[model samples]
Target: MKFRRKHYTDDTLLALYKAILKPRLIEEKMLILLRQNRISKWFSGIGQEAIAVGSTMALQEDEYILPLHRNLGVFTVRNCPLHQLFAQFQGKPTGFTKGRDRSFHFGTQEHHIIGMISHLNAQLPVADGIALADMLANRNKVTLAYSGDGGTSEGDFHEALNVAAVWNLPVIFLIENNGYGLSTPNNEQYKCEYLVSRGAGYGMKAVQIDGNNVLEVYDTIVQLSAQMRENPHPVLVEALTFRMRGHEEASGTKYVPQVLLDKWSALDPVSNYEKFLLQEGILTEAVIAEIRALIKEEINVGLEKAFLDKMPEADTKQELQDMYKPFVQTAHAPANATKTEKRYIDAISDALRESMLAYPNLVLMGQDIAEYGGVFKITDGFVKQFGKERVRNTPLCESAIIGAALGLSINGYKAMVEMQFADFVSCGFNQIVNNLAKSYYRWGQHADVVIRMPTGAGTAAGPFHSQSNEAWFFHTPGLKIVYPSNPYDAKGLLNAAIEDPNPVMYFEHKSLYRSVAAAIPDSYYTVPIGKAVLTAIGEDLTIITYGMGVHWCLEILAKHPEIHADLIDLRTLLPWDKETVAASVKKTGKVLVVHEDCLTGGIGGEIAAWVAEHCFTSLDAPVMREGSLDTAVPFAPTLEQNFLPKYRIEEKIKKLLAF
Candidate 1:
């Protein structure tokens, strides 16, 4: 490898060859370790190194790259330290995830690499989000997202591509057609002649190339990336290649034809590239020997350090601290007295508007949230104030929107999403539980996004629209659940949720959106999350509730002056105010937990259990709990009224008092 110039400099060409060669050599060593049972698994990229190396090399260092699990060359070429990479694969403390996760299933901003989950296609929309941030900031940075032959068949693939093309983001979606998706042949993948044709259907520019040819991959990326930076649009590139080894050493390739393997062996990228370098007089026999020797030493050192490193501590203390991270906050002023009072929905909208003014990087994404002002007009006139770039009206792609919000969160932006109806959040459940909820625990990604959930039963919206499903997220760790029952708490909690570093599910009961009203300060203020509010004072009994449940308790107390009880409104559910609830439980010696969700799996059960365990001696009677019946919310007005806990909650309060 000597300094010289041709269509490309001899030094530059030699470096690309080494970068491409490194991962192949690493995979070869890993294969040996796998055979000996020294390592757990190996997803070999032996025959498909060129595309990873060339495509990554084409992007600027500041730009982002989301690589598939099989694309090890993308990491090596980006100068990700070999020792740390090996440690991560071996579950050592020095790994990127600090041994929290094993193998190449982790991501860090250090290498501009966003990690991939087991759900491969899920990362595509996340790529759009990173690019969306750069696009909004008017930065020339582009994102290159990789997917496999099988990933194109996933719903995320289509949704992500459509989002990118519709927004005209600077994204390069690369597909490495590596013959098989874990033993399922390409014939079973799709009907299209080539994966590149699918891009045309999305109205995106696309092309196909020989993935084996390093120069073709490199030159194509350089050309297309330059064009994208100038115009800022997305394009898809399909690279036809073959993986020499099985998907993993465990999953053998007996499913593939021997004749095909023999043919591809002849076009082995590493050996053929070395031959090309020799044929071009760019490298000598001595230099080739030096390159191989250098790689051998690096691999040996990386593996040695990884084997000697200490394993991560798995004690309760360490595990507890690893679940979430905190962020800095801005100061808040006390609310000013005003003659005008606001409704629950007004308070939420005001909180969002004020938060946007305070946090410049705050972006809002949802369906019909722009010109239509959302279904309930919570974001009315926001587009005019914040501009369409900040207030984006997204396609009805819940998975993509949520994934993009995570992408934005990691890239130094805050996003607030509206779930038209809380029930519809089921569409983006995977992204929420797997990606958003687990990002911090898996890696150190902050999910600084708020999902505004309009929930509860009313207006005959039926089972699909009126379900109160806060328990779904309550069951998942690393998420904050804030369900405000009135305007005062609504404003304060929404602001607090936006300021929180972790993912927050803000469930707003649609039935209380207009019915509930309170005199709240017109200025900015945040009610601390995880703190239950003492709404009413009494000695006879204690009532614990949130959201619409608070309204029922208050209504019953108002109708009967003799029924005095201390009402505790749990503003935040995940980090529930245990001290407040416990203290209240002890004061009254009689306790009842009420919630709008079904009784069987509702959060009310969890609260009741906690109270029973801690305040068993203080109880005057058995700890009581009440909730909606174990059934879907009904469609008819009368049936829906019967299904809700409002009517029976008063009777339950009377029963608890009588006990």
Candidate 2:
């Protein structure tokens, strides 16, 4: 489909001139604020204003933009309130992030603009996911994702491009080749002749343009965007410009040569655009002065109002809870009175199947999740039942899977991401901890995603395949961690996680896949998150455990009934049932925390510390903790058994009883 080229009228020229001027003025104000110590740092887009303004102008109002820290012109072109921008840089309460973040790190949901983190290329997969959602919904919207030439070196950039190409997503990957990534020159960044040439390798249309030429950049993006809206194919646009300023205000460009700086300075995008407008006779001297005076007055007025705004209060307990709030589905009883005894793995499958049946917007993505039904057969027959579009088999790219799921969630789809093994979660740790975990706190965006991690040892799957990595995410805030032991809780917690608004790491222990079976309700129901279930109640002691540890504790209790103890299954590790644990601890006056993860930084230490601090007066003994030795999970069964065995737990119980 051929799109009519956009005609640049006097109004268009004036708009472009204003768009270029606004960001320059804003950057100048920010640098002033930085020198005055009113703002902490400033990332000036002084020289590359044309790319932000031109590309954004080409996009439809409803289209989404995932911008980088230096793309101030995108904000101005999108009409982001000047006062809010000032307030954000000033760290005032009226800022978009409520002063939680500063400078180009906040987004407005209403505007469909995603805030960015310092890890530059992370947004690429998210943009792909957003475009995927639009494609799935049959919408004409396209997504424009921005990155620096330096960010192209990241693995996420390649993964995102591959997924977008394979799926034919309507996403425009805009790489601002600003000659330098901080102090690193383009020569050191990549071996490619042109960054846009890499797009052909990914099976997408590609283009390289003089980024300083606003008219050319705007025309190229407008034509490509028009085609993408109908055909739904990814496009790569490499905008070649230069970073005229230091990386940030404080980082002086002393390392840059004087000759190169002078060469680029003469061709400054803002100044060149003004000159173009004058040559075209689109603007008179009086009109140019009017535009400058108007923008300066606007900036000054916004800064003054922002200065008067209050700072965020220090009381953050409630704020934290509000930021991490999960989506809750309406309560409903099971459809029938019938119950079925299902194994842990089968129950997980049932929960996913039922969830998809209920929520049309729910999508499952992972390696071999669709056609193969996952390696564990947990998603068996889902592709045939729900179609391949919903049950997707992603490339062996963990970072892209999790990052795209975050994007899907933001676009109003509930995404269920699967890690082939719990240990492999390390591959996507940056996205999980940095992007998914911090998105809500940094910007009020809900990542309604459920990450299914088939976890644990006992089967001796070795270090690469078998690991209880829950402790890694447990340390990160703005994430919900659910590790259910039995089939009943497995189905219910998985269902709850799918319904949640925040990102949830749902761990299904591989050891319990076929070994454990229980009667689960036939209809939909949710097990409340952050709640612990009491398998056994006793007055002598309380055993706090989750996942595989829950079964071990139950076995110990069954073997020695005389050892009166409360066996509590902490189904949710994060926001762990503190109330339930405190009540049990106060009654028993003795507590033991157990898990299969290694000892040093295991969640066992956190539980023990909590008991020591909160239940100190009631304690009859020091809080005992049991876990694997602080080393990589051994490959040999003999070593693994000695590391975390039922006998070791029993021995600890005997010592606690004697104490």
Candidate 3:
């Protein structure tokens, strides 16, 4: 087959030949290992090597690249040590994330190659945020985000493109069209003739390229990257490549026809590029053979090193440390005020409104927040007070909503993003875990964003509408998790969260939103971000809780003043106030942990275990825990009251008193 070639240089051809050989050898060895049962599974970027290499070469060393799962070629070209990549694939301790992250989530910011998120299309908006950061910082570094054609079908993709284009961020959304997303083929993935056309609707610069042709891929990226740098607008570069292997290790080519594979195989990018290199006089047949042998040898060494790498230690103690990294000590508040007054929702609103006034850079955005004052009315009158620019309403795209907020914060604006309910936050979890949590630690990219979601049960909204998912964020590092149970702490802790340099997941119990009210102080203040507050001081026993549980425990204390129960409300769960908790438990000589989340791996378990380990000497009896049952929060009001942790605080307090 004859292929048309345009202006091409010797260096470009040589680069292509090098790029294609590296991944091809790795894939070849991976297949061999898979057949020999040396590894469980493998996914090869065999057919798509050219696009990764060509596009990456167009980028500056300081620019960022977000690769997808099948982006080994990009990783290899960017000097991501092959041994580390394979170790990550093997789930070894020497992996980039110290084996805490999965294989695809591997990257070193030192190489300006940001990690990839396994979820499709999730990286697009994050790329926009990173690019926006560069633009605001007056840096010329662009961010190139790669995803599959199927990813274009996700709402995140459209939302990200729209925001990036509208803001004119310097980002390139590279969609490698390998024709199938798992078992679903391109025909099923979209009705639109092509994915890049979606960008036109969003007013972004879009182009389609023959991804298998290294020359075409490089030339096209050279043009797009240069244009994006100058204009500082986002563009979509759809690289039409072919996935020669199965979707993953477990998947087989049975779902796809052999004929199609043969057809795409005929256009083998490595062989095509090898021919191009020789034809351009950039390489002789001897040089190509030598390069292939060198790449294979390099792959063999990396594979051997990976096999010899140590497995990650599965010790819970080590895991705990890994889970709670980036922890900072926060000063606890003074003795509980003799007078306590305020409603949790009112306190939250005050915190947001006051923070906006105090910090000009602090902006608040959400759906129906500007006029409707939020579905829960938490931000009532905020828009009127802060103006449209500062307190704006966004479209009904949850993924985009948080994505844009992240982008804003990355650009030096402290953004408070409110998801109507915690349940809906699943739409933006990819952005939260993959992008927001890791950005700062990965590339020194700070994301000072606050994500407020009303979580927990007792609303009787059923599984989809009501849930407590603090554990999700708690499991992720580089994020602060705060769950305040009262009005005073809500207002104070929220102020601190907004000011903090890291991303924070502020979980307000949905059941506490307006169900009860208290008198919140009018003065602007900040409560420490990772500290607990002692609601009631006593000596007989200690009751630990947060969010709704704090109020419930306080109510129990009010009814039984003679019980001598000490109540500690954990205002922040991530950097939890261990000092305050331990001191209280030591004084009481007995302790009970309470929370509204599920019993299994609930935040309370961690607290109870910690107290057991650290405060066991002072304990007169076994430490107790109270949390919602293992079952899901039911929709029925009566069942919800039983399934939820509304009454667990009282029950636990009674048990402690009896002990």
Give the least accurate 10-residue stretch of model 3, judged by summed lDDT. Answer: 331-340
Q: Which portions of model 1 miss their true places by more than 4 Å?
A: 1-6, 328-331, 335-339
TM-score to native of every candidate shown: 0.97, 0.97, 0.78
lDDT of 3 by residue, 1-659 (tens): 33345676566567667876888788888888888887766877888888888888878877888788787878888888888888877778887776666666755657866666666777677676667567656777678888788888788888888777766888888889999998899999999878878877988878999889877787788888888777788888888888988888778778888999999999998887677666757789788779888888888888889999888777886654443325463533433444346577888887888788878877787778887899988888877787776676766667876766666664557778898888888888878887778765443456778999888877679987778889878878778898877677788888888877678999988777677777655777778886677788888888888877877777777887788777888888987999999889889899988888898988888888999999889998888888888987789999989887767667766776777
lDDT of 1: 0.88
**Clashes in each model (backbone N, CA, C under 3 Å)?**
0, 2, 5
Error of 3 at 225 (Å): 2.6
Give all candidates' CA lDDT scores. Answer: 0.88, 0.88, 0.79
Residue-level lDDT of model 1, residues 1-659, one tens digit each, is 12123377788789888988899889889988877887787787889998999898888987899988778988998888989999998888799888878777788788899878888789999999999999888888889999999888898888899999999988899999988888888889898878988887889999998888776788789889999999999999999899887887778789989999998888877788788888888889999889989998999999998889888876888777767786544546565656358999999999999999989999999999998899999999999999999999999889889989988987889999999899889988988999998889888887888999999987899989999999999999889899988898899889989989899999999988888788888888988888899999999999999988888898899999898899999989998999999999999999989999999989989999999999999999988888998999899999988898888888888888889
Q: What is the lDDT of residue 207 in candidate 2?
A: 92
Q: Candidate 1: worst 10 consecutive residues by lDDT?
A: 1-10
Query: TM-score of predicted model 1?
Result: 0.97
